[model samples]
Target: MSDTLSPKAAKLHNRTLITTYLYEHKEATKQVLERELGISLPTITQNLRNLEAEHIIELGELQDSTGGRKAQSYRFAAKHRVAIGVALRSNSVCLCAVDLYGDTVQERTHAMSYTNTPMYYQRVGTLINEFAATVAKGGSTVLGVAFSVQGIVSADGTSITFGTLMHNTGLTLETISQSVHYPCIMIHDSDASAMAELWFDPTIRDAVCVYLERRPGGAVIVNGKLYQGPNQCNGAIEHMVLVPNGRQCYCGQRGCMDTYCSLETLPEEGESVPGFFSVLEQGEPHHRERMHTWMEFIAQTIVNARSVIAGDVVIGGEAAQYLDDSDIAALKSRVQQLTPFSTDTFSLHKSRCADTNSIVGAALRYIEAYVDSICTDAE
Candidate 1:
């Protein structure tokens, strides 16, 4: 829950907290920071001073006081530090560089099969490093790396235990990080994507996110925190057998959401989801129906999730490229037809639209861990 170090970590912890909030609100006075951070005046002043000295944060114009003296406000220097996040699925890898506020600064991706092989990791490492080199070229300093993969990630961001959807190659975090060749870390694909929503999304203070990429996996966010259970695979929902009596999933289950909803369910050679949609666009009613079934399955899953950790469902993946207004509406309609409610609260999200999400999420998580390490030492 906290970062490492004694006084330095305490200072970085406070800076991370203050800067995190400021990244959202844009600006806040010391009094507002005190109320939100719940720290003493000296601690606030001290940390803010340290952050300013480090060029990680900046002070803006003062806010008018209510019948009192004006107070100076603080804001995160979004450009001062840079972070990288990478989302690696079974078929492809996406790497991005993001700013302090989760803004994509630079990004690129490489195409590869998710199956575990030395070549795949080598390719992934090359892509990430290539993007980092791009970041350096753009004159932005790189801070750290975050890796989001499809499997069970350790809480410490050190290793992956179960990767049902990845190359099935059984890769070790140590090996991958060594290949990564920077200050690197790892996270579950869902949790890392959810971190994208957490540090940057303003409306989602509380919600549940079910992210589906070409690879089937997801993470849940409760009270603005990713709920990672022991072994760090709490929300890896693709393994959950929804039908228990249907199609065989890669995870050895019948009729799971992943089997029905993923592109893998649709066999093709060297095809993108956009190409699949293009087929539908060319009037392939069968593919169209496949999409409809996919959305319906997603809806039913959300409706079922309501009994547990329900709030709002977000659909995001490489498949999101073809999610037109009509597709989204149809998905909503299907959910409406199946669920108790008339209106659909589940939202569709797209990360491929943002070039820097992976790097950004990685950077943010790294910074968060850096701060979390500091606080626990004191406790």
Candidate 2:
């Protein structure tokens, strides 16, 4: 490699860099961009003009003068573009539209069965198009859509390789994309939830997000990026055999972690996880004992996973939000005692996104892809 950029390539690189920088910082003065990007004043000005003309960025305010003329500040026009995230569940599809700043602009939940027929997919497509039109009313461009499915997703994010909750296997992206007429990608729901945790909490660069939803699963993050193993099952912790011959699992396995750690294990007294926790919080001895046992199982799984992966464990999904700080601390203590390694501290975190983490994360995937495309074009 020559280790140098051609004039044309350099210009593209600088433009992408400036745009990305503004996106991260929200707003910055031209002087700050020039200093940080190490580009000349004229080059920065030209790039800013180009970005502004494209409606990607706009002048915000004047920077405070330092014994000289004040410089103009710029910010990304985040509302100018939007991305859609669809969370496909067994009984409903939850849609969310997120702006460039990762804020949810609109959300809607549509009730539907996870059918393996074209008619069902077409209906989903129509709903997505109608939602997009609603979002576009404000003159925002619909960049793309990402679907979150609770299953094993293809490495390319184009299909559902396998799913225990969904009736369809090998479901192509076109099943939904054909109706919406937009770029689309499919993501494992667990992976999407983990991405949401990483997005909200930057401190968690490397961690295992244990998703304790209706269908239990997990996602592995290493070096600030998702690490999909050779078979794209790197974080399929739910399949880990907890007992040799215990409760049966949907994956045709006996005593799988999912059988013990999933929401299905909870009592039917409450309709939702939060409602169940409310009963526990009221000093209900039966539910308390049940929760204790559940926490113990989760602790064991975390210890076993940490022995191999060696990172913080974040409990995510609908149930995580209901777990108080004391509950998490107790779980951490249990994991510490179970682990063989000598560790002074254990990093356990609760998910910030309540029930919509996966939805936001799905949208973030497309937004990140958009940014990556800009950088790739520069390259």
Candidate 3:
């Protein structure tokens, strides 16, 4: 077959290219776009006009010229449409509004607890709608809402296939989407966190993301994509057994990694992870010992995971933010001692979106969908 671009395909390709460049660079002039994209000046102007008419792009102040008339600048209207992401936890909910560029525009937390009853679902729907209403007041379109649940999500993102922690197993997407006046979907919290990492750093071809939250969970990225297993539980690393007949995990598993490496593992009876870290930083002997054990367990888990999947390990979630440089060095040393090969073969990375990975990732689901729809449109 001949390698040629049809007129329609070329138009679509140019539009996508121009829009993507503006989105990435924030702003550009018609001449700059023409020069950078290698498109004809008229074609660049036409695409810019179309984008501006659609409210996807807007005009910016003219740039100063060296020896000619000032050139008009165009900018991508990143916040023209926003996506909402909700993270449902056992005791509270986190709501975030993200723009097309995956930047969080607004975020809030609610003290509501999770209950599988219809009333609870209705309340969640109401909260989402109310939040959207506030966001819409800024004259921005609300594209959709995505829920990040700490459970196994169905392949179609329509139901919670496994949610023992929140007792929300079998919950359907419609239960909450019904009250909200926009597109919606369900997503696994770990999966969403992994997506956020991929969005933040597209270079991650293959890696393991371990979320050291109160209840540890993880996701796997294979070949630059999420590897959902047959049961869509490919990255349920928390359930991996670390010891036989040891401490019980919340999932009722004995000696699971969650019981040893989770943030919950470091805290005292009423101390939070932050409090535990605070004392640990102060050189308290008890906290120091607990953190040492925690790092050892985490190192072992990373080594075990690498034995099956070879890639960088990204440590994320609420607890990961507390990990300082010294902590990373200690963990790296521990991991090096466990592996036969050199530690230089693999690497450990701290999550850039430590606190908001799941929330941002959840919202990015719809933002990406919108961009895909635009880029894939043939007409």
RMSD of each: 6.4, 2.8, 2.1
RMSD of 2: 2.8
Per-residue CA lDDT of model 2 for 5-91, tens digit only, reads 787777788888888899889899988998898888998999999999998899899988888999889998888888999987778
Every candidate's lDDT:
0.68, 0.84, 0.86
Q: Provide the TM-score for each candidate, comma-separated.
A: 0.71, 0.90, 0.95
lDDT of 3 by residue, 1-379 (tens): 0127878778888898898888879899998998898888998989989999999999998999989999999998988999999987878878999998899888889999778788887788889889999998987899999888888988877888888887778888888566777888888889999999999899999898888888888999999988878789998989999999999877888999988987877989999878888888889999988888888889999888887888989999887789888788788778888988863577787887758789899889899988777655456
In terms of lDDT, the poorest run of 10 residues in model 3 is 1-10
Better of 1 and 2 by lDDT: 2
Better of 1 and 2 by TM-score: 2
Q: What residue runs in model 2 are displaced by over 4 Å at the alpha carbon?
A: 1-5, 34-40, 62-71, 268-272, 375-379
lDDT of 1 by residue, 65-184 (tens): 788788888876666657788877555677777765566777666777664667767777788777788777765667777787667766665667776555443567767766676887
Cα distance off (Å), candidate 1, residue 185? 1.3
Please report how far candidate 3 places residue 22 from its true position, in Å: 1.7
Q: What does the lDDT read for residue 298 in candidate 3?
A: 91
Clashes of 2: 0
Which window of 10 residues has the lowest lDDT sum in candidate 2? Answer: 370-379
Most lDDT-accurate candidate: 3
